[model samples]
Target: MNIHKISAATIARTACLLLALTNQLLSACGKPVLPIESQTVEQLVTAGITTVAALVSWWNNNSFTAAAIQADAEYARLKQKGE
Candidate 1:
């Protein structure tokens, strides 16, 4: 299984995406745009936790898929060799 490590850059990118989405949703509701950094400390922590959870979920799903693909390839190789 090729489990890749998540980088700071990845986290930052996801955070930015989440921020943009939040802003868009708020704007759609006739609300003022509030950037993530402008939020209170509690809000910021909540956002950070949310972002991390999303990233972890994504990583877990991808890792499982990768492992499955790797296993399939190995099985194919072994079967071909046996044949």
Candidate 2:
């Protein structure tokens, strides 16, 4: 059986959820408040978004490269006939 490792982005988002739940529990109990940095959530969102954008960019580049190569090959074949 093959097991897929969970991604960092998923872990980060899970941590964000845990942080929220922890704070809620703490506040309800009247315990000492913990400091929750907004940066953690912001960074996680940025990481997830940038990862998706990069994958899309990579796909576009690979397809464009393949098409360019095919066009070059066709151009060469036509040039040979014109000679």
Q: lDDT per residue, candidate 2, 1-83, as tens digits?
A: 99999999999999999988888899788762575468976998999999999998887635358788898788779999995
Compute the lDDT for candidate 1: 0.82
Against the true structure, what is each candidate's TM-score?
0.38, 0.38
Name the runs in model 2 displaced over 4 angstroms: 35-83
In model 1, the clashing pairs are none
Q: Give the poorly placed runs of model 1, Cα more than 4 Å off.
A: 33-83
lDDT of each: 0.82, 0.83
Q: What tens digits encode model 1's per-residue C-alpha lDDT throughout 10-41? A: 99999999988988899789784774344585
Highest TM-score model number: 2
Best by lDDT: 2
Per the 3 Å backbone cut-off, how many clashing residue pairs does candidate 2 have? 0
Whole-model alpha-carbon lDDT for candidate 2: 0.83
The CA lDDT at 39 in model 2 is: 98
